[model samples]
Structures are given as C-alpha cells and as structure tokens.
Target: MSDSLFRLDAAQLAELIRSREVSPVEVVQAHLDRIGGVDPQVNAIVTVAPDALNAAKAAEAAVMAGEPLGPLHGVPFTAKDSIDTAGVPTQRGSPIFRGRTPARDATSVARMKAAGGILLAKTNLPEFSYWIESDNLLSGRSNNPWDLARTPGGSSGGEAAAIAAGMSPLGLGTDLAISVRGPAAQTGITSLKPTHGRVPMTGIWPRAPRRFWHVGPMARSVRDVALAFSLLAGPDGQDAFATIAGRAEVGAGPQSDRPLRVGWMVGPGFGPVDPEVVATVRAAAEALATFGVQVEPVGIPALERDFALDVFNRLHVMEMKPAFREATRGHEGEMYRMAKTMLSLPDTSMADFIDAEQAAERLRDGYADYFSRFDALITQVLPIPAHHHGADKFAIDGQEVDATYLQGATVPLNVTGLPGLSMRFGTSRSGMPINVQLVGAWHAEATILHVASLLESVSPVQGLFPNI
Candidate 1:
C-alpha cells in the first residue's frame, strides 16, 4: 500500500492531480484501502460504496479527456449515515430504517460528488442521530481512533473517527448543537458549521432540525474545511433554508490591515468551567494574541449556564418529539426508552414550541448584539474532554451537569441561528482532542476560519496519519 497517498491532505492530492502527478483513481483507492485497514476496529463506516473505485476512475477519465473539474476533484470523502446517499443504505444507525436507501443523493452528497469528490462510504451515527454517543442497532458502535473503549463523540462520531484515523480526508457532518463540533473535538479533526441556512439541510435525518440543524464539513485541516465549504455551499432547490447561496458563500473579505479583535467567554453563560478546559481556552486565546490579534474575555450573561441548558433541553425535547415518537412506539428496549423520555417531557407542548422559538429569537438577537462589538468569540467546544463511553452525565469543575451541558459552548449559536465553528485547540493527556470554537457574525464564517487557521498552525492537534 502507498501510505503516503492515504496520508496526503485533500489539497495535496488536488495539487498532485492538477499537476498530472497522480490520478484521481489512485487517490480514491488509497482512501478505500485506508478504510479497509482501520474501519474494522473502529466500526466507523456502516456501508461502503462498491462502486467508489469506478467513480474515481470516471473522474480520472474526465481529467484525461480535458473536461471541466470542480475544486475538490478526485478527493475521497464520507457522509454521515443520517445524510442520504443514493443507492447506499442510510440506516441512520437505527433498525427502524434498516433497509432504507434514498433514490437520490443528499444535496450535500450531490454537491460533493459534483465537485469531483468520490463518496466511498456512509459513516455511523447514534440512533436517529439523537444521542451523543454513536451507537445504534443497525450500524453498531464507533470507537475513538485514539482509544477504542472511549467514544469518538456523536452523532457524527463515525465521521470524526474515520477522518481522525485517516480513513478519509473529509466527511459531511451535521450539527444541531455540537454533533460535528463535539465529535471533531473528541477525535482530533476540524469542522465548520456554516450559518444555518448557508448550506442545505435537505436529506439530513430527523428532518425536523430544519430550524436549527446545519450540515457542514469535517476535515483534518482548516484549508480542507474551506474547500469543502466551497463545494457544499451552493443553492439546492429542495431546501427552504438555503437562500441566495451565491452571496451566502464564503470567500476572502476585505483584507484587514489591523489585527483582529477576539472576545472569549470564560465559560458559556455558565460561571465556572473545568480547569483543564479553561486552560485550553486560555492557551488558545493566548496563542491567538501571538498571531497579532487582540484577545479579551467577553461575557454573555443573558446566555448564562441555566439559560443555555434550558434552551438546549427545551429545543431537544420539543423539536425531536416528532422525529422519534414513531420510532419509540415501534422499537423496544433501551433506545426506545431514550426516545420515550425525550417525548415524555411535558414542557414540550405547542406553547412550549412557540416559547422556544421566541427564546431562540432573543438568543439570536443577543448574539447579534454580542457580535456587533467583537470580531470573533472564542470558547470551549465542551467543558471537558471525552467521558467514559455511553455515560449519561458528567461534571465540570465538580458541579453536576447533564448531557445538555455538553452543548454549553455550542447551544447559543444553534439557538440564535448563527454560524459557529470548532477546531482542534490541543490534545488532552489521554490523547483526546481539546477543541475551541470561533463564533463569528451571522454569515461571517470567513473570519472565523481565518482565525481558526491561525490557531491550527500553532496547536499540537496534528491530523491523523494512515494506519493502512
């Protein structure tokens, strides 16, 4: 096996293909081979595309025949099981949809393929993409690339694990609050959640997240993320949220002559955070200062701990009932019980939905005001590193917190419908990834990506190498 080929970044492979130094088929084959080597132990991929090799061959033919190519031409990537893939079974890590395969690729998958990317496999996710841990009846569980007994984090855990293990350079992962960002943090990959409507949420599972869910790129490098964003950002007619993709897309804004100003919350609307996580956030901010940016702590008292948790739980309970109510009635046992609990809550009535929407609006307005003054917001993707596998609850700084708190640094963005990104800040002692988020103004992912690129350059969060 050519280890170097599997290890090459998407941009590196693109350069080689563009220079006629390597064929697209060769690049795609390398990723397939990488999956073969590592995916068994990790169980990150649920369904492999038998025709990926053929697709890559066709891409090579296109290049050889002098056809127009997309920016990610010949890059190999994966999609989360929750996202539809044509001709591939999208089990969504649930038995309820066991034999389900869409007649069409998801808007995101179609966009990636159209951009010259080869979709090799469908990655695993939690059942119905509901829980934080990535395990389900149909696809089973995904283990962390660094530690098998530990979680890679979910519902995009499989995507994160595969990318971290070099099974693929990039994967399409969705985030309601922190699925993409959280898993990326746990597995040592980088991701960007474009503004809610910037990318189409069509074909993403639980389909109810139309209001808050965002589908975006998970990659090993910031540049790869930017490249993925470019491919995935175009308008798709099926999605209602996507408005004017032509203008919503990211690119170089006016070149800044002044060092950027950064405002970071010590924690979320919460008071104190884990020492290690706070250290990581502080270290990340200090690292940014060295990049010639002004870093200062900014507080969002309105978005405080209780309020953030309230927003997260209310949204989860209210929004997810429709997606899982049917599944619970049919499916039995633990997973069914979990879904029941989410649906069983009383605070999720029609009035509650309206209230949540109103609260979401207020939250959005708050972020608008917050971003009005600051160029970027820096914060922890979570209060601490990955907990034991399948653990329901955790504590930050000795205070008991629930799974909802896991979305601490993340929920506000979702509530307000703003774009926020999480990238690897550093690594925890256990080799778990410590990550930070950069929340920019509404559609200003370019600024956040720019600063994240700066942080990625200095952090010890190295992209995974191929074990194949």
Candidate 2:
C-alpha cells in the first residue's frame, strides 16, 4: 500500500484520503519516503519542507473531523525553488540567494495550500531560473529519470524530474519560454502553461520580464493538471497582470454540438525538428483525426515572417538583463552559466526592440487568425529528445542549431500569450520520451486540456513510466 500510494496521482490520493481508505499522513509519508529513496540519483529536490508531515497530520485531523475538504485535500505537491514558500527556503537556484526564505507563498503556492494540498518540497532549477537546464550554483543539477545522463529540462527541470520519479504527484512550475513544458516533455509527464495572466506571478523571481513569465501546474495526468489549473487561475489582486476575475472553468473541449478543429505543424516557422519528433506530432494529429475531430496540416504566415524566438530574444533580453544585473550586482562571483551568459549578451537596440515588439504583435495576430479557423494546434515540444548535460549545440535533422532551438515551437505561445499543454505521446528509438505540444488560443486552456484528455485516452505511450 505504501508503494502504491506513491504511484497515485493527486486526484486518486484525494479520493482515497476522503474515503478514509488512506490517511493523509500515510499518503504524504509515502511520497516523503519516495523522495528519500529516489532523490539522491535525480538531485531534483533541493529542500524538503520541514513541516510536511505535520501538515499531513493536520489534514488527517480534518478528514477525521468531517470538515469540508478542498479539491486537492491531503495531496502533496512540490514547487520549483524559484517559487516562494513561506518559511521554506526559495534560494532561486543561486548561491547569492541561498538560505533566503520568503515571508509568504507565491499566489500559486498559496492557492494550492488553500485547496488542501501539502507543500512537500522545493525542487531544483538553473541559476536564477534562467536556463533550459536545471543546474545551479546552489543545488547542483537534476538528471532525467528516464536517462540519468540526460537533463530533465531547465528552470522547472527539478519539478518535472520529481513528479516523473514519483517524488511528488503534482507540482508548480514557471514557464517563460520552455521551462515547464520542455522539462515535462523530457520527463514524460504532463504540464500546462495556461494562457498568460491566467495565474498570478506574485512571490516568484525574475519578475522583470513578467509579461512572458507564467506559473502553472505539472503533474502525471492531464486531469490532475486541469484540476490544479482550475484552482490556481484568476486574479489575486496583487499581480497587476492577473486581471481575469474568478476561476475560469477549464472548457469541456469543443462545444458538444460541433467537432473540434486542430492544425498540426513541425517546420518552416519552428526550425528543423528531428524526424522522430515530427512523426510524433503527426501521430497526435492522426489520432485526433480518428477521433472525429477536424485535423489538418497548416502553417502560420506571421511566424515565418517574424520568428517568435528572435522576437522573444530581443524583447526579453532588454527587460530581463536589468533584473539580472540588479540581483547579481555584488555577487557576480556566485553566478552560474545562464546568468553569466545573459549578462554577456548585448542589449537590444532601441530600433531593434521596437521591431521586436512589432514582431510580437504580428505573432499574436497570426495566432488569432489561426484560432479563427482552428480551436487548437499541435506541434513538437522540442526539436529532439532529451540531450546530454552541457550540450549547447545540436545537429538536428542535418541542420546545426543552438540550444535555443529547443524553444522553437514553445516560444510562439509565450509571444502570443497563448496556452499550451505538453504530454508524452510517443517514444524515441533510444527509449527517451517524445512529447507533442497542444496549443490553444489565449484563455482557451479548457479547450486544449479537453483535447489533451482525448489524446491521453488514445496516446500510444499511455501508462509508460520511467524505469527509475
């Protein structure tokens, strides 16, 4: 029962706890034990919440007392180190902020707790949460559970690794470009990057580029992600960007009367993708087609004209560099690869920044136009499967590309403030996970999640967990 408890998703745990079949303490202890046993190899958890068991005891009391329960009542959840957890060290994955504990939880974390979820631990991330890999000066690095030699994917890599390894069933991760989704893809888990502004960013780091930053849920199942999203979304009043009031219902796919329309693409705008990755995207589209959904291969002209990655780089660097400079002012010696790299990059020229802004608008317009005809889009989450640690260049499908190429299909969503779900749908020949991105127009998280649930039912890689 203890071993099986660690394997259950958050929803399942909640059901068991509510039914008195499993005590909250038992469920939380199982995950804590799992972390103790698995984290040494994964290096995913940075700091376990000292009061985790105590919180579980309190939750158990609630169940015993017959108190009203929240949706995630008694389930344990982990968060990236970059997200604040009151009294727990948030360190931001850098030595400069080591031992820095926040006085309050981030809006996402607070909401999770409010829903009766236990804060299990804080996960690892790259220095300043800026890289695509989760290595940092303070907590070392995180390895993919699927292949220890390869990375889980960065910034939110630790959260992804933890959930994949069964250390935590549900977790919170922030995505600027590919932090949440890329890591989820590499780890063979499911993650949701809800429409921008859907979740508040209060108490999270690197808020300078707040427009692109998003806080969302990473979990083992699409329904768990959807459950977490429903609880996490809406205005907290503290974040000016989180203007959407109340919890927006996760849409129930396309209206029951009409079939959903989806477009699948892998190139031209997103750069050269590996053949396997392309095949995975095609398979997802084909699966949707067989489900009676309108599926077609399509391209967005604006993405071809104004590459979203280039636009993101220009706009973000100008805004993000200042925050990095301010944070690392006196602690430059403690900085790691990503911070140093970001600091060394040239600032965008005024003219170039303006051009990039226009490009971003164009990208948004292009997505709007696409959504006008299609309800969602399908694309490869990464150009290739998880790569070895420290790899910065790759020969993807005969084209030499930099590491940033991994964000090709993902950055456009950030640029357009759209929502996307990343879930495992295929496996590479080498046995690594290959995930496809499910994209929805702004505020259409429900629609994408609905489609993702459909894909989840038909995914060829269903119930496949890492051998770890």
Candidate 3:
C-alpha cells in the first residue's frame, strides 16, 4: 500500500485523504520512505522537511475532525531549493548560502501550504539557479532517474528528478529561460510555466530582472499542474509585477465554442532540433488534429528575425549581473561554475543592449501577431533528450551547437511572457523521454492546459515513469 501511495499523483492522494480512504500520515510517510530509499542514487532532495509528518498528522486530524480540506490536503510536495521554505534550508545550490533557511515562505510555497500541501522537501538546483544542470558545490549534482549518467536538466532539475522518481507528487520550480519546462521534459514529467507575473516571485532569489523569472508547478500529471497553477497564481501585493487579480480558471475549456487553433513548429526560429524531437512535435500536432482540434505546421516570423536566446543573452546579462555580483561578493571561491561563468562574461555593449531590447519588443509583437491568428502553439521543449552530465557541445541534426542551444525553443516564451507547458509525448531511440511544448498567449493558460489535457489523453508516453 505504501508503495502504491508513493506512485499516486497529488490529485489522487488528495481525494483519497479527503475520503478517509488514505490517511495523510500514510501518504506523507510513503513519500518520505521513498525518498530515503531512492535519494542516495538521485541526489534530488536537498533537505527533507523535518516537520513533514507533523504537518501530515495535523492534516489527518483535520480530516477526522470534519474540517474543510484544501485542494492538496495531505499531499506531499517538494520545491526547488531556490524557492524559500520557512525554516527549511534553501541554499540556492551554493556553499555561499549553505545552511541558510528563510523565516518566511515564498508566496508560492505559502500558497501551496495554504492549499493543504505538505512541504515534503526542497530539491536541488544550479548555483544561483543559473545553469542548465542541477549541480553545485553544496549539494552535489543530481542525476537523471532514467539514465544516471544523463542530466535531468536544470535549474529545476532536482525538482523534476524527485517528482519523476516518486519522491514528491508535486513541486514548485522557478524558470528564467528553461528551468521549469526543460527539466520537466528531461524527467518525463509535466510542468507549466504560466504567463510571466502570473505567479509572484517574492522570497525567490536573484530578484533582479524579475520580469523574466516565474514560479510554477512541476508534477507527474497535467491535471496536477493545472490544479497547482490555479492555487499558486494571483498577487501577494508584495511582488509589484504580480498585480493580476483572480485565479486563472484551470480546466476551463477554450473561451469560445470554436475549434481551438494550434500551430506547431520546430525550426527556423527554435534552432537545430533533433529529428526525434521534431517528429515528436509533429506527432503531438497530429494527435490533436485527430482529436477534433485544428492543428497545423506554423512558424512565427519574429522568432526567425531575432533569435530569442541571443536577445535574452544580451539583455539579461546586463540586468542580472548586478544581483549575481552582490550575492557572490567576497564568496567567489565558494561559487560554482555557473556563477563564475556569469561573472566572467563581458558586459553587453550599449549598442547591442539597445538592439536586443528592440528585438525583444519585436519578438513580442511577432508573437502577438501569431496569437491573433492562433489560440496556441506546439513546439519542441528541448532540441534533444537529456544529455550526458557536463557535456557542453553537441552535433544536433548535423549542426554543431553548444549546450545553450537547448534553450532555443524555450527562451522565446520567456521573452514574450507567454505561457508554455512541457509534457512527455515520445521516447528517444536511446530510451530517454521526449516532450513537446504547448504554448499559449499571455493569460491564456487555461487554453494551453485544456489542449495539454486533450493531448495527455493520447500521449504515447502517458503513465510512463523512469525505471529508477
């Protein structure tokens, strides 16, 4: 029973707990036990919440007492270590902030707890949450649950790995470029990067250039991601950018009665994608088409005109360097590779910075143009499946590219503040997970999630878990 409990998704656990069929203590203990047994190999969990069972006991008491239960009542969830967890260590994957614990939860974490979600643990991340892999000097590197030698993708890699390995049912992760979606794709889980500012960034680190950063949920199922996003969205009045009011109505089908129009693409703008990935995107598009939705191959001219990854590089380095500098001050020796690499990069030239800013606007306008004609977009989340750890270069589809190319299909969503969902849809020849990205217009999370749910019904890889 405990083994099956560890395998259940958050929604399923919540229902069982609410109905008294499964005690909160049993559910939480099952995950805790799973973590103890598996984490030595995965290294996904940074610190298990010492009071997790206590919280679960309290939730169980509420269930027995006939108290109103939250959506995630008694369900254990983890968060990337970069997100603050009151009294739990959030070391930001660096020795510089080792043993650091926050007095307050980040808005997302607090919201999750308010929804009756138990804080199961905090997961790993790259130093300062800046790299494409979840490895740092403080907590060491996290390995892919499917293939230990491969990365799970980062900076939310640990959260992804943990959820994939059944250590947690749902988790929170932050995304600047591809942290949330990329990691989810790698680990064969589901994740939602809600429209920018849809969720507050309060209590999360590297607050600079906050416009691009997002806090979102990572889970094993689309419904769980949708449930968590509904609970986590809206303003805390603390993050100025989070002024959007009211929760996004998840599970809401398209706003209109018309057939949803979705465009799928893999090239011209997203860079050299693996043929396997391209096929996966096409398969998803075709799957949707057969499901009575209008799906077609499409491209956004703005993506081609201005490579979003390059534009993001020029703009963010100038805006984000200060915060990195402030955090790494006098602690350079303790910093990890990403921090050192970020600090060593030369500042963006004034001309290039201005050009990049204009390019960003143009990209946004281009997306606006495309969205006006389409309800959503489908694309590859990453160029390829999870790569080996520490690899920096690859020959993808006959073109030699660097690791940064992995963000090609993902960064544009960040630049435009659009919402995107990553979910497994195919498998690589090497037996790794392959995921297709579902993108929606700003504040159109429901639309994309609706489409994702539809696709989830037909996903080739549905119910597939890593062989951890």
Candidate 2 — what's its lDDT?
Answer: 0.92
All models: lDDT?
0.80, 0.92, 0.92
- Cα deviation at 57, candidate 2, in Å, is 0.5
RMSD each, Å: 2.3, 1.0, 0.9
Error of 3 at 62 (Å): 0.7
Candidate 3 lDDT by residue in tens digits, 268-326:
99889899998999999999999788888887888889999999999999999999999
lDDT of 2 by residue, 161-210 (tens): 99999999999999999999999999999999988888999999988798
Predicted candidate 1 versus true structure: per-residue lDDT over 257-307, tens digit per residue: 766889877655753477877888889899999977889988875675237
Model 1 misses residue 66 by how many Å? 2.9
Choose 1 or 3, whichever is better by TM-score.
Answer: 3
Q: What is the lDDT of residue 467 in candidate 2?
A: 79
